[model samples]
Target chain A: MNFWFAVFRQAGRNLRQTWTSQLMTFLTVSLSVLIFAFFYLIYTNMIGAGDRLSDDLRLIVYLEDDPGPEMQEQLRRKINNFDKTESIQFISKFKAYERFAEQLGEDSDVLTDMPKDFLPASIEVVPLKSLRGYNQIKLFSEYLATLPGSEKVQYGQEWVERFYYFTRLITIVVLLSGALLILTATFMVAYTIRLTIMGRHEELELLKLVGATNNYIRTPFLLEGIIQGFMGSILGLSALYVLFQWISLHFAGPGLLNLFNFTFFPPMVIVSILLGSIGLCTIGSFTSIQKFLKI
Target chain B: MPKLVHNQDPIEPKDIPGNTMIEMIKVSRTYAPDIKALSDISFTVDTGELFFLIGRSGAGKTTLLKLICNMDTPSNGLIEVAGYNIHNLKGKKLAHLRQKIGVAYQDFKLLSDRTVAENIAISMEVSYKKPRAIKQRVRDLLEQLQLTDKHDALTGDLSRGEQQRITLARSVANSPRLILVDEPTGNLDAATTERVMDLLTRCNKAGATIVIATHDSSIYKDGNHRVMELRSGKIHSLSRNNR
Candidate 1:
């Protein structure tokens, strides 16, 4: 339609006429999106590592003393009978001492100086595969503590609870920060586009005098905002991808990177970012048009 | 020639009856506190008539035109144009109302950045006219206004008279029902002024209710059309040629 053509024509003209200011808006949106994406990647990898840790959950129930074989069998039966217990393993005191010696490699003198039964025997309980969440594992640990002949129930103690708490805090912080970044991007785009509109104030008054409706006047601005938003997001995402690749290549080791599973965002997350950028820009332009045009 | 309706006696806007194109009853426009542009002004112009508003600078001629076209709202009273109350019109209704009216401002408010043809086409383009149709319309206006050579010239590059002609061409591109022109000959030579007046007469003959605001004596000396002179913000006198 001619109406749409005019809108495009006007939008294109404005883009060219105010490229300097528009580029500032584009860069601001890009930087904001990049910051948020970086936060997202960090948070996602932390959560992923925490999830892997939870999946490999092992609850070690140290015994009061070396229980007899029959008593060990009874304890195993009692733990397995419980609702969420998947499987259990019994380690003899000698086997525990051997494992401890393996952990203290190059320090065989410490083991020789200690007594023969220095290590305590233990039963390791694996909860139901479905019980990987923090609360579920804690409840299972509490159930294990009730059994007789058990010294202490250690579900990786300090780290598991702390990691779960950290995951929750990171999630909340990332979400709030991402939202604030988006808000800042929206206002920046609005302010930048407002300058562009002010530059064309004379033309706008002429358009109004010649009988342009509010929709007709606003269409071009909306289109401009959408295009700017889409471009900025693409730039941000591209920058993020390059940075991730650089870090991955530079730190090509088997320690933290492999443990935390750090990588570029998934395709689905990228798509969401693109869509969100467009929406933010559109909202910014709409705000500017509503305030400046006032029609 | 278009009909020039002469008022034999004083007639208020509220008292004017039958097929009126514009009616303003006690319209007052005040800016801020105690600065009044127009006070209790009332007038009526019938359809298909050529009328002139004679006044000095800052005599509220431009403000009155703005009020009739709904570009600016009247502070106090009623303005009815094309059978719709101007105060109640908004959005689509206001736009539609404005579409039927054309204004050539005293300062010739042409988009200087655009070409002369573009300036003319914009008037028709806003109404969603086809590109081909707009091109033809612009061409015809260019020829009619004797600005065919300046069609591609930037409006800002042209002389004031040329810019005024482009403004006129743009204003009448839609063949509006009402044409409100303010000081159309402000920057024209005597020869150009006659040509401009002739072009307006041609549009008036095509059935546009024309209102011209001018301090030029040549336009009102003949007293052919009804002339209303504003001395401050009130109508100083209203008269027409007796012949």
Candidate 2:
């Protein structure tokens, strides 16, 4: 038989003989990976929400009362020339009054009582996508405040920036915790494998004595680790997907899905899962074999 | 009339003809700073020779065997097996060297999870033998050892003697040039010991050098084979029969 085929067959036999131990390993791997996936999902959703909030924000530069047409055109030109400005829309006083009237349909008298002089014309500046972040929008708005005949600059960027900062902090914390958890899980799994190998040290020694090379002796254990890691990742990912779908279906509130309309995992998640499983198994195998298969 | 021979404890050294297959020159094995297991010992095993190393416990017989297999290194000496200096071999070449040598442990190092066939197949598998060839070889070994009926039995489920035989079968399955047996008869009954020794004799006749380390000398009468008696970390004498 091929060398690897023998390794695999031996690994299969080992797994069959120690099904309980293998099952325990599988559960440990699956739970750890599942926790990681859940945390990653949360982190991804928070980032997506922050991005959407920034995208929808616009900078409003309120106009001075009775500004002349030349000044208006000058301001419009100035707004257009700004590097951060993507598009500018001029809201005339009449259109503002009409919008007010529309909003107060049942209370039209309140809109009629407000004098025409009380309304202020404004220019809405939509910034480029790169300038849509909290700090970037704040800097842009502060610069716009110094413009001539500008009554005030109003944008929800400050609150959004605060939310972004808080959520970004949360994402960092969650990501760090996830990383630590993954390391812990890997170490634990490796130790378990090592102990299991120790229990069968005589068998391993026999194999070495019978002319089994390091690779041939280690292949089965490595495959076992990989199988456990794969099973864990799949279980974790399936659980996360189910949880995400269930939350999306039942809990339509201001949490992750509703606030961000968070996108589901693309093909990349599957690739990541494969890579993660293989990487963990490789590390576990390398470590276990380093000590067990020596001489 | 039947021949009458003296039952000496160890035969005289002049009777042994040297055709060395394994040689160790001034070998000293010291673990850590002060633990000296074997010190300045030299010996040789001839081709197709059946030799016994007799000593009490902690006499370094196991360590000697391990050194021959290159599993452990000696503190100082030149150790050669099958005409290669063992310390220089590494990686696949070391594996190749090990393939030429077979070792049996007193613990009966059979893979408990595997069947008798699989346990025996490991030897051929490492040598990269073809599947059909491995199957045929395993079948032939099973028949030779009278273990054909237990081919599918788990190694752990077999009796002590059967397990030891399986270990022996695995050791000789690759038809190694040299076999290092550590306490081969330590755990076997009298009948089983005789049977195992008979098998070893057969293997020696087939041209494989056999070196057995044990404390049991009741069954091994003097003048039957060469005997090396070790005492206090040194070879007290090396003798053989004048057959």
Candidate 3:
């Protein structure tokens, strides 16, 4: 206990002696961590939005023209019995024409000039939350096409699959980039601390001559590094939080929120930041001391 | 007791009783591959003995001290301090051996950032002395070295004489069994040198072995301590006076 007290006292003395150096270290660490946090937040928000979009995805099943009520009922039963089906809505040929007319607006004469039976009735099939993506939706559509009186089945599987794939690729890229940035920051901090230790080589030699063991001599400097890292982390976290709030307030539209949502920073993210800061500090201090304590 | 004469040869280990404090036999140290600092030197210091090593500046006085303190290893041969072979000691054992020996450098290597009391307290702290005991010991040493008034002053603020005295106090704070001083009075006035030597003699009386390296001949002229003069790299002569 007394040993640790002495170590802290010495660390305090070092901080006072090199306040400018400490401040510089703090700024460097803080800026790096802030950048990491920003990228992490973006990645997290993108994943969340992607998941929501995937969950709400719907499969549209177009149908053959003018099936009798009995055939339509049978089709509905088949879809309801399908394992992946959540719900299905039927649209008759007349309703499809009406929707086309609504889209044509005051130019409804353009649709009226077309053949009356050209439009096809369709069932809009919504899959269960668990059954998503192109493969499952394609299988369901194939089953629908084999049903009696059904000539065609169509859904937006191509675009939905492409969207999912693109988002997944983006998430992977973000994760890889974040990991690389973290590694680079760690190495940079370690090198900085090593340089600081080298600058004080003469003082260290004097301490060694006076009978200081490696631990006794190193504990204070290591503590200083840890304190610097922690302070930097706190500063970075606060700055990130303020920036996130400002962006959220200034850009409240769904298009912007869909890209950069601040609400995605869960409790786990805060824990991760804490652990990351400590790990960086530990690596920096340990590496620096390894070189400095060669004697 | 009768005083030994000048130029008398040191007693061989085979002829003497076993009460030696330090013994180096054929110790050779080569810093670089080509630069031999100490070449096959052999000597012993008995318990509570005051021994002086007089030599030129580059005659390896500091290297000898480092060897005895286990800070460096011999290139060849054996060195035993307080019956422990120093060549084989490492890590914790080396630290233990170092704690038993007090060392003072010519530059008065005091920690400039700490106060005089704190500087002296380091020795006691390393030895795991209790805080209260360390405080009292610091006080006692400051008074003994006539540095009581400068106890709380920063070491950098003190004069060279005062800083040297603080270094001495730090060296002796743990009551080490041996004191290795390299040019303890090199930068001091004649009066300060006498005072430092007197303090060292007092420590010798209290059963601490003293090994000093100096170019100052005046100290050996009036003292009864054994003096080993180094001409080139090897011992030129070993003598004792009856002052």
Candidate 4:
């Protein structure tokens, strides 16, 4: 316990003695972590948005003609046989026109001159969450087309494909930023420790001369690196949270952009990033101090 | 006693077998590019003896100290200190060996950023417990060395003589079994040199085996300690064995 206390005190002294360089390292690591977390935050929220949208996924099967009540019942049975559905409602041409009018609101008069039966009747099928994949919906659409009076099935395939690519791009960016963060933190920390070691070269030799073990000399520097990593990550996360709050209130709130419900990283991800940065810094310190402690 | 590292799972000192604090047989150290630092050197120091190595600056006095401290490896032959092969000791064992030993370097290798007390306290801090005890020990050594007022002064800010005294204080702070001194009176005036030597002599009388390396001839010329003269890395003569 005494030894550990001394090690910690030495580490604190090291940090204070080289505050200039240490500060630079801290800021650099913080910036790297912020960039990585920013991308990750967006990626996670995008995934959440995608999941919520997918759960409300609807496959509208347009009918060739208004099917009799018995045919509608049979079609419902067939759809159930293929896969369960949250709801399967049949909408007549009149109902479709009324719904379109309701959507248009002030422009409802524009559609009054159009014939009532101009719009086709359709069966709107809301699939269960488990059956919401693009391929599953596509297969279900194909099967729906074989129905007795079905004209075509539409599930906005092009839109889903586009969203998928956009999310993939976000994921790739997050990964690249994460890799850059690790490298930056590792090198910055290594450089800081190397400078400290060189500055205290004589002191280290003296310590060794007075019977200090390798562990005795290395512990302080190791602790210094760890503290840097821990503090830098926390600072970065705090800055990100501040920025998140600003954006959340000024942009994503109700009556604002309403584009996304932006959220900060979950507890697990935050813990992971903190642990990863610390581990990276330790490796950096470990590698850099090896040559100096050769004696 | 300091108990050196004082680890719970310590590798017990392997059957020391005798009171021989240091033993060397044909210990030769050859630097790179075929430069011989020490050649076929053999000697021994008993448990409570004060030994001196007198030589010129390039006579491998510092190199000898490094070898005994396990800071360097011998190119050939055997070297043992405190019963363990100095060359074979690695990792914790080597550190443990170093803990039981102390070296007062010729260069006054003090941490420039640390205070005088911090510098001296380090030796004991590594192997001792209780902050109050470590602090008291540092105070006692500082008083003996007449550095009581400089406890909080940075070592680099002090004069060369003061720094050298701090080095000596640190070496003996941990109460090591074997203390190696290089040029103990190098930067001292006559009065300071006498005081430094008296402290070392007192430590030796307290059961510490001491090996002092110096290039000074006048100081040890009439001392009653065993002295070995090193010329060009080989023992030239031995005299004053009236221990």
Q: In candidate 1, which residue pairs clash?
A: none
Ranking by DockQ: 4, 2, 1, 3
**Model 3 whole-model lDDT (C-alpha atoms):** 0.75
Candidate 2 chain B, run of 10 with poorest lDDT: B2-11
Model 1 chain A, poorest ten-residue lDDT window? A78-87
Q: In candidate 3, what are the lDDT values of residues A1-295, reduced to their tens digit?
A: 2667667776786677767767777787788778778777777776676667767676666666676788878877887777557777778888888888898899898775687667887777788877765577777778877777677766665666676676777677667756754665566557656666676666677666665656767777678667866777788878989998998778878875855344847778787786778677767777778777775
Each model's number of backbone clashes? Answer: 0, 1, 0, 0
Candidate 3 lDDT over residue span B1-243, tens digit each = 111111221222232347788898998888775788888788889988999999999888888888888768888889888777866765445555566688987777787877999888887665556789999989988887778899899999998878888888888887887899888887788887887888899899998889999998887777687888766567777889679
* CA lDDT of every candidate: 0.82, 0.76, 0.75, 0.84
Tens-place lDDT per residue, model 1, A1-295, is 2567778888999999999988998998888888888888889989788878767889999887888889988987787777556778898888898888888889966889787687888898888777678887787788788889788899887898888888888888789768966897798889878998899898888888887777778888988889878998999889989999998998879977888878777899999999999999999999999987775
Question: lDDT for model 2, on a 0 to 1 scale?
Answer: 0.76
In candidate 3, position B53 carries an lDDT of: 92
State the lDDT of candidate 4 residue by residue for B1-243, as single tens digits. 123345532223344547788888898899989999999889888788888998898898888888888778899888888777877877666666777787898887788878999888888777745789888988898888888999999998999999999999989987888899999999999888888988898898988999999977656776688898888889888777552
Off by over 4 Å in 3: A66-119, A123-173, A252-264, B1-19, B31-33, B112-115, B128-135, B152-159, B218-225, B239-243
Interface RMSD of each: 8.0, 12.3, 10.2, 3.8
Estimate, for each residue in B1-243, the C-alpha lDDT of model 1 and write its tens digit. 111121221122243358698888898999997778888888888887899988899998888888887778888989887556867977665665676688888778888888998888877777778788888989988887788999899999999889988888888998887899988889888887888888889989988889998889786576468888887777788888553
Among incorrect, acceptable, medium and high, the docking class of model 1 is acceptable
Alpha-carbon DockQ of candidate 2 = 0.32
User: For every model shown, what is its TM-score relative to the native structure?
Assistant: 0.85, 0.82, 0.79, 0.88
**Highest TM-score against the true fold, candidate:** 4
Q: Please write out the lDDT profile of model 4 over residues A5-98, one tens digit for every residue.
A: 7787789888888999999999988999899999999899988888977976899999988778998899999999998999999999989989
Q: Which stretches of candidate 1 lie over 4 Å from their true place?
A: A66-83, A92-119, A129-148, A158-169, B1-18, B220-224
